[model samples]
Target: MPQPTGPATAPRAPATASSPPSAPPPFPPQSGPPPQEALAPRAPVPPAVSEATRLLCVGVHHDRAFREAVLDELYVHEERFPAPSVGIDAGRVLSHAVRARNHEVGWAGGIVGLWLLGLIVSGGLLALALLGSVGLVVARWIRGSGSADTGVGLVRRAVAFYVRWLSRLYLVYLFFAVVLAALFLGGGTFSGGSGFGPGLSDPLGFARLAAFLTLLVLAGIVACVALRRGQFARVVSEELSPSRFPHAQSDPAETTAGPRLSHLRTRLRAEQHQPLVMYEEDWPFRGFGTPFHTWSLAIELRPRGEAAPVPLDNGEILRRIVPLVEALRVPSPRKDPAAAAAVIDRLRELRLDECVFLPADGLEWRNGAPYAPDAFAAHRAAALEEGGEARRHFLRIRVGGWDEELVVTVFVRVHTQGGMLMAEFAPHVLTPVRRGYRLAEREARRHRALSWPGHIAWALVHTPSSFGDSVRTLGGWLWGELRRAFAGYAGAPAEGPSAAVRELGTDEDLSLFQEMDLDRYLKTIQDRVAGGVRTALREAGWATDEFDQKIIHVANGGVYIDSAKDSAIGIGNDNKISHTPGGKGGGKK
Candidate 1:
């Protein structure tokens, strides 16, 4: 036999290429974490040694390309196959290549020429008539006097106009053909009388006309379909217009060299004597309107048996799935804390471990705390509400392994307008197929429920009093007490807004946590301040003799000042302090 191809060497030994330096031989797996060496990061391979991995490391982490790639793969895979299977490596390779080359499928004038020629050859005079009609429509509908045949911009606009006109023309032709055929056939009969009626002449002409009409209608339909396909091509072209069209396919045989899945599969295959399948699926976290940005996959680890297939139940399989989940999660500018936590819960329910894939940013916060995407979509608002404005996005993932197979799903949601994308994987380890789907229902639902009111409240309450935005700032002691009461969670406080109930204007003391202004902002500063001062005096700390409390209102700000010894005490002169700015109690105003 011809000598083996020298391990298909590419700088490093095949075993070392994929496996960690300290890990056991990936071919024959080790029990129990493969030692600490297996967990250790692999030495950096030179860019020339393996460009794919190098590019993947940089590309996926930097931009949304890898994230979108996974989503696109999952959606396509789900569409093509039912109950997803990643049985063939060729399928995954082909799908990946298709997505990779999606942007490059351009009309190089040759394709356009072919299409035009096809139109002429196929439609002949009818096609010419349609083109003439298109020209007329373009002239009538479009604004510019200049010919649209010159610049790319003009050409595009002209093409759009032409296509739209062609579509309408096709519809009209189809309608006339149908109506005419009905009138002739129904109103006349077999070349007698009125053809369709009893007094008509020959109907053969009508028949031929109908046939030609049918043919024309079909041609228009075909052209419209082709045009839509081109539009899809254009969308892909727009998405992948970046300068770098780098391929991110990781080699399976290389341990730490390429994508983690590739190496893990190689090692698992070496250890087991059975066939395997692996794939992924995505789950959305944000409300319906946002995109499904996070994903999880389930991998099947089945082994061959005489009676039925058996799956491996190794703990290491569980261990490896965690990293795979982590790898699927791509960083986006928009992120929501509660939604993210919900994603974690969903992943755990799916049995994919969450500890391995936790975001570097800590997830803990008070009830109404906002996070990342909130930071990115930042806005300035003038509303006198306690809560500041916030924007949210979501990402979720799910992964699992079953009987010689692996699966994963990633969902990505960005912004309030909500662009959602999902990635799913089928369960075949050898060549796990990836696909993607857009989350439409999820996208719509989020927009409806997102709380613009609550965001304004949070902003108003969170902003400093010096900003002259706090509604209760002038309410003095009463406002202070109320504000303090509201500061705690809605449930614990003795007096404050109640929780968010669906009904309008009823209960006042349930809990106001996430709900916007359940207890309402102070209605009038005069009444609130008078009430607050009385409450504060009842609570003591202020003596009329030693100090004086006076309310001062200027164009710059309103202040509660204790004017004693010619100095302001209770509230700050600069308007920053809420109460007792000079650290002394005040006399009543």
Candidate 2:
């Protein structure tokens, strides 16, 4: 079991002899508007507490200390990080709305068919037509011109909204449909022999039906009340949890328990001279066989009194780091360049999609500058006075192909206060709709090309193998895409570095093909980036203490350490790291 490094309660400051006592440090400055002057002021830090402890205490007020350490090492500033905006395309929403309307029409037609069957069985054709006509007219009006505003646009918006909450609506529809079916099956007025007359003989059946319908109506009214109170959306979001899509299953052996940074300060108290280390791995988007993975290692250096021989600029640091990173790239032989070349040729010949791995370039640096010191001027001044300087830099590499692009960003910062070096690696993969369609078309053609006997045999084997589940999954996937396309726009600035776009195939084009070797491609890229950084840092002699190292798993905007047995409830585990048993004592070997 992992152990705490210090006393459970906050530790007292160490006493110093000969030197005069210093005043306590002020709280860190915050950005944005100031609070109302009438609001009460914050309490002052205790004089006995050290400056470092004061900062750490404030930072870990809400979160675990280990979590804060991981975050700080990664240089993850929520204010500076560029998160992607969730916005939908208006045109796609309109198209999806039209498709949904058509589907509803087909459903109406099925109802008409059922009514025809009833007419043959019980002779209520006139009544059936009357009932069906009213439903059809109302549905048509809603899909057509029910909007007092921008008619069709309003209808489209309504359709999109309904689709977003389709899971809930589906339950209501099922209940109502079952009730209606029960009424029909119970041999009621639809049988045509019955009318509003004293000859009515099935009073009990009628009463049961009326009671069941009344209960259903009341249940629906309660559901509406909950929805009006905004409870439904909250519940759905919670049920969906971690992300919009479900996590893919993987080998259990692939996961391992490691140190969590949330307990860093406690460990630091035990071994003040030793550096703290944390690692995080992220598979940002998965479940469609995402090709890329990112891993970040954060090392927190102990504060040093002496300055470096010379101040290093971002360009010089990147120049030294690039070679180390590039050295980990997949070798030409392993990459099978010849096979990739052949695949490209075949794609061109067949008019199918192509995959092209652009020539890998050295690390490119951007946004390098001295960090703004206004927010934490006192802290900055103290670090500078002690011969340390703070700076930040962003490095990116773009790997582009015919239909896919994998972009990686390395955010590096030097913290003057702790003499810390913070590095973060973020990888994002883009797969356009055209690419997905092309893959689907390729699969269909492959199925068609199989021998008739073989195809029949394959279908026999495959049809029962989660066929219904697969169809529903695909439907859900398409629905999500359409809903996202219609989602409301955010006015925030666009996130992350921009990529150059190159048009390959038109949206109308598609071809039959097997899966691309994207996993290997992305893995190679990841290896190179991780390997290069480790090598560079080692050569610089900054990471000599191997025992203090940690690996973290970052996902869904949270950082976590790996362990043999799952420890926490809220943390994610897909990309966890392994550690030796009882390795938590300041990472001592």
Candidate 3:
């Protein structure tokens, strides 16, 4: 939720109630081209956090296996910015998934081994070679040939497309290899490579027989490996529903994936409650929602007439503002079950969180010793009262609407330094999660159906791609592990983390009404904040003339829509996303 407001750069004089201008052009219109900030560089997501999100997307979008659902939410491009984590525990989720991922990875390696074994056999080798070459050519024809117009056509996208078919082709190779082994079954004997119990004698035939046995063992392994993935999806889905959206405080002991995984989950949860250092270094708005729109205004704290300024800190400034901020509170649940629940749900979504971000390097560390009480107290002190350039505190308010599909979050930070009082308001919106990501929930809640033609057809079409997923997943996983190994070796491994999943699965652009709601929320909060600050300044006998002028301009991008305005680029109406609007009034947004 944000409004186009802040320190006004415009030179217009403040309007008096007795006489106001006829009209002023809308300063920043929603219909216009995307805001400049939209084009800014994406916040770098930590590897662990990103991987955890990908797994959830995988489970939700693709039910059969646990592989990253690449490029599924093509339009969810904007909301991918890493924000403060909401309800989910990143550490626990990742911990549980590690064993399942490793299981898949082991099978992936087995698949590679089977392919190599097939290469050593007589007729099997040539068939694989022919099919692989033909598969590449046919796949290109179906996928369409790559164009050199894009960079890394040969090494990147083109190769990636080529790689996608490798698992599928290998699957075919396994079948052909098995058939060849059967055909030569009579020609080999287990005891000797001679005509002992068959028609022909050949060591190659024996080799084929052993390879075929290995393939059978692998098939069983595939079945076992597929189990953990489903378990993960089920556990996650059960805990995180319409009410929770993304976060669920899952019990590690009860929802155990494995012994090692359970232990890890327990340890991680403990760390979340008590952390030794600032680990998520890259995430500044940690434990807060994604910051989308932010405006800051700095005003001189000097008194109007020469008088001593009252000593002010973050806590004191907040004391003057909290009363006004309390105007928007969750009302008591009304009667009428459905209406009451929806209203309460909407109100409940509007959450306010307080956290402090502090330094870690200088702090003493003793691996076996308990986390120092003094360090924790220091953090609490900074969050509640103290404010410095480094130890920054914030008031974070989040409103999750549309069954937690769309979220509007506003963050407020106030501090006084060097005779200047700076106040900042930043609003972040997380658009609705992709429809595909909700498929898991649908599949679970709905009644079982007879295997219909359409369902079968869909499966058949995706079969080849599905078989290929694990190989691709393995490659990516291995790369990440290798990178982490290197980073750890260099003593620069990423540590701190506060990451949310819903943002990663959101629509690229927000809907028209979503935009309107966002504007409304930001304006509402910003106005209240401005009023409280002005009141504080006045109570202290400071000049409020300049602040008032800037406030007016910031309120609506300095525009009176009815006024005669200079020619400017129009806000073209071109919202491409489709989303359902919710809750008309009474905080049912």
Candidate 4:
């Protein structure tokens, strides 16, 4: 089995109010929380583990679809890239989810107890629903609503949950009705006997008393969930820390071991551990996630002053801009020379990788694929030296700021073929996770006594679907495990970004500050990349005026990329390079 892939740094407990010791980060988190998460009123957020737990808690506590997606990928297939953080892992999140589902499914089983209570009180048509629901639920669990797809199957399963919950609720009402009918009986509670001296002698009186008792129990639970705050989402996030759940330092399958789920750790790691930023086919770039902005400039390299033109290759151009882009990661020394913090003040998340992206079929899938650094380095060098449409080269600059809630990525590709120095500048942004996810943090800080009723009402509203959600969760899990054990799920159809938890709650558009930050990151990196192209031109005795003009045009937003389809823009000759998809690049100068 393949090992888990991600940051090698082991996870630690979050620094809470009780034990507030903090280790200095490689750089500061940011100036403040992201816009959506800004009003949460949380303490200074802990580093990787805290944010990671919150992410996990979202899947564990709130979203059932996310759980299915994560588990399906973990049990069935391999990952495309290494995890970005040590704490936010597929296996760890899946274990937390499994623990949560076990508890929910356990509670969902109480419907059977409700049915038995109804059977004892009254065995009418209602009692049959309570009894027959067990068989229906079991059948549905086995059949699994075609659990493989996310479309109609998900709706069908959710409907099943509501149906089961409703049947139990009906039985509760029947039990209440049967208990209230005991006013005319003589003694026995079931036989209408006067077993109790004071109670069940009048139907109205019994109804009032039963209503009061039920409300009391319901109110107490909802009040505790709302006021005490421990039952909220953020608490789950904190509880998932390595101190509470030791999976951070070990295999997660051990925490919630089961034969139902196979290859928990291997599939989570996905074989490659070097933190290669994985993307999706949302836009022009297949695996580069959504495209925020893209601009390319192709300028002919001419000898300056009739001098012989020196050779300039794509590797040289890419190599030149890489360190220039990486230099941004360094923090400037404060004015006070004596102040040596060894940490950044703001904008901490920075990473740069020079690598090749192979097509999905081109990935190495052998068991325990050895990490040969020298061999990988040579492969990257070859990609830079000889670029292809399928085997592409890139200098990826990723700025994961705002607790990794907002990420800005810049993919720089340079090509110096046929005397044309072509460069593509693409910038993409991952917006803050869904606003609903940040609710846990806010809920943790709340202590509203009056809001308990609202909380109760909210719980009541979602109660009907409890059966379907919980049962489907387990049903899907068991089915997946069986598939992994027998049919082998390694070759299941690929689900690109949907399985990615970080990308799950992200919005299409960036927030105000997030937009500004992304713009700054893209511009700074683009400047460095463009400068490298110019530097190579100067060294090769080539005229850089045409390239400089196009750079200005791109910076000023004077170029319209969307207007052209399957085309490359060129200057100097004032011609166009037509690129046909799955065909060759053809044009005349």
Candidate of highest TM-score = 4
**How much is 426 displaced in model 1, in angstroms?**
34
Off by over 4 Å in 3: 1-84, 106-198, 201-254, 257-260, 270-283, 286-290, 302-313, 332-342, 345-349, 363-377, 380-387, 402-405, 417-419, 430-436, 440-507, 558-589
* lDDT (C-alpha, whole model) for all candidates: 0.27, 0.29, 0.47, 0.51
TM-score of 2: 0.27
lDDT of 3 at 327: 47
Of 1 and 2, the candidate ranking higher by lDDT: 2
Cα TM-score per model = 0.19, 0.27, 0.58, 0.66
What would the per-residue lDDT of candidate 4 be over residues 447-473, giving only the tens digit for each residue? 232265666666554433333444565
Worst 10 residues of 4 by lDDT: 580-589
Which of candidates 1 and 4 reaches a greater lDDT? 4
Q: Report the C-alpha lDDT of model 1 over 1-589, residue by residue, as the tens digit.
A: 1111111112333455667777543342211111222222222211112222222222222223342343233222221111121111222222333333332123212233333444454334234334433444444345344456679658667666676566556545644654565445423454455443332244444444444454554344344433433443333333222222222233221212334334323332231111110111121110011111112212222222334432222222223234444432322223653333222111122222111111112223212212233322332111111111222122223332111112222222211111111112111111011111122222223333447564334322221111111111122323333644554422331111111000110111212221111111111212222333323323332222211223222211332322222232222244321122111111111
lDDT per residue for candidate 2 within 240-310, as digits (tens), equals 22231122122111122123222322222222111110111121111111122344544554322343333
| RMSD of every prediction | 30.7, 27.3, 14.8, 10.7
Worst 10 residues of 2 by lDDT: 349-358
> What ranking emerges by TM-score with the best candidate at the front?
4, 3, 2, 1
Q: Residue 294's C-alpha lDDT in candidate 4?
A: 61
lDDT of 1: 0.27
State the RMSD for candidate 2.
27.3
TM-score of structure candidate 4: 0.66
